[model samples]
Target: MYCFTDPWYLPVDLKLIKSIFQKDFSYFNDHGMYCHPKDNISMNLFNLVNEDWKNLRAKLTPLFSSSKLKSMFQIFVDKAEVLEEVIGSYSSRNEPLNIEDVASRFTIDVITSCGFGIETNALKNSNKEFMKCGVETFNPRLLKFVLMEVVPSGILANLGFKANGAHTNNLFNNLISEVIQYRETNKVFRNDFLQLLLELKQNQEMTDDQIIAQCFGFFAAGFETTSITVMFAMLELALNQEIQNKLRDKIEEVLEKYDGNVCYDAVMEMNYLDKVLNETLRKYPPGPIIPRNCTKTYRVPETDVIIEKGTRVIIPIWGLHRDPEFYPDPEQFNPENFNAENKANRPDMAFIPFGEGPRMCIGLRFGLLETKLALIKLLKNFKYTLNGRTKVPIEIDPEAIFTLKIKEDVWLDVTKI
Candidate 1:
């Protein structure tokens, strides 16, 4: 069923997805995600294709090397500690906490420091410039996203149709350009993402727009996805007490190995914790849909139903993750599904929270490790359970663009362990 179709906008099955991503990839290389080299030069990686994307990916890959992420442990720990303090205040008062709000702010701080080499302290100061810009760009209203996703560029351009809410976009681009200028002028060096992007702009003739585009891409891809994953992980922990305790035990056991400190190695060592995170993403993936449009005419093999040029194709990652064939008792949250032995046996493309192919999320390591550290700190200091203030069944905001978020809030009660 077509997603934009009237009534129910469900997803297509996996067979169709494999053809698009794998077997017939040549025909579907261009995702046609919103792009404007003139107006939205900051919209880079998501739209660029062929040589442009390939060259940039090559230059950017080494910066995100695992060793680079390992060097970022201090940033993760510092931000996670801030989050813990905020949660500590709530736990002390026996207050019912809307944890997602806290998690969103925590991720904002993490993304800010990592993405721009700036510490936002968003939890303490709600109006941080970087955090405000990030929210504005990513979680646009549903109708807006749909128009951008479905409506042709010709229509938008002819009608002078601009997406609502450019305040953040303008603010962020200005901040990034200023930061880049400051860094270049002073010869300032940092191991964070901004430093790497600066290296690109200097070494590669990547225009200011390209530089800003990469920064915006990281901000869009990093913050919301990590926050959603963190909230879902917490929700599962609150609902499934035994699993929560087990995960906590794994986190504690690993941290004990590293002198009660959460580091990259300690996080990686928590295999069970990894499985839990994977399972959480499987059930409540932040990016539920990956939409791509055919850049040129293509043929669907075996069937004579050739998809004409410029047809819109939607890949329902959410449906595939929930498919009963791939995961028996799909609704049950079982970490064992991602266990080493089981994961080895699963199909290559079966798990795609981050999507597949050459265009997989560039900031995945930073995003995942940040979330892991936050969860470790929270689980170590506090134990949480669902509070009565929480909506009984989570209701997704049909308005928000990417995240599978609730219109109300996800509330939880916590006690100091």
Candidate 2:
């Protein structure tokens, strides 16, 4: 496929996709996205290529380990409780809730608290600066996206073009600097991502700009992707009452084992919830496409076609996910599609909401834990149904460049169970 003069190889073959992501990763290691040297926030792990990505990933990997996430689990529960209160107010008034907006706020609070070690109280106060910054950061401008793709990063940097707006860059820069300064001055220590980053900085393993860029990337990636997953999961559950009820039952059953507390272990015990989340990801992956850059000339396995270095590779994740060959009745929102037997029958690469191999999303576990906690909190306490305001068949926003988003707000009628 050609976008203007730039050619992209859209590979639909699963075997080739696997090789691109894993086996032949050395040839396709970079994402090929433009990142201006002037844009510090854009130089995150997601955008960095080769050694930069590798070093940063190695340093940050420990911060998201099982013990680390368990330590952060309480943050998820606390924010989810706030989310429950916000939803309860709407349920009391018999008002339908725009779940996407509410979930976005919930995730904002969670990410801020967990990642920045600060409380933005986004759920209670929707007009917070963090909320505004998040909205602006992700606002899809088609022209900007196209220019970034077609133009070179150095040229863009020379022309004073950045990946993010001035407001976003300034807010994150100032906010992170203030927090780091305060923590150092007070000798404060917190078991959060920022604290870990500070330790890395103290050890001279990371520079100030790298730390700021990572914090920005953590917020930018963490909140929206998890919130989108929560929103879509709720939408699907509302549309499929039986699945919703069954999932709630599983949640309750698992919580019972933990004395009715929604702990890390209890959430992990809910295998059915995993299946539901997997199915939701399959149907509405946050990132519908995976982009990779060919770093070296590579010949197609068992073919004469030679993909030149610098060629862009587009792994059509959405197309493969919805293909009828892998998923019979591809349009159906059935959790059973992810059950042990069914999943075993499908190819491993067929289900990649998070891209496969090394460059896959680093925050996969954190994202899933946050998303599952939100669903458990909401479903265990309330019964939700699709409100009339939501379109019967939701439409995907054509302008959503980065993530999968519904064109219309997802409104659901909620009643306290």
What TM-score do all the candidates reach, one by one? 0.91, 0.98
Flag clash pairs in model 1.
142-399
Error of 2 at 284 (Å): 0.3
Worst window of 10 by summed lDDT in candidate 2: 131-140
User: Which candidate number has the best lDDT?
Assistant: 2
lDDT of 1 at 359: 68
The TM-score measured for candidate 2 stands at: 0.98
lDDT, residue 238, candidate 1: 94
User: Which pairs of residues collide in model 2?
Assistant: none
Deviation of model 1 at 245, angstroms = 0.8
All candidates' lDDT scores?
Answer: 0.77, 0.89
Off by over 4 Å in 2: none
Across residues 144-223, which tens digit of lDDT does each residue of candidate 1 receive? 77887678666765665544256766766788889888898999998787888777677765767778878777777778
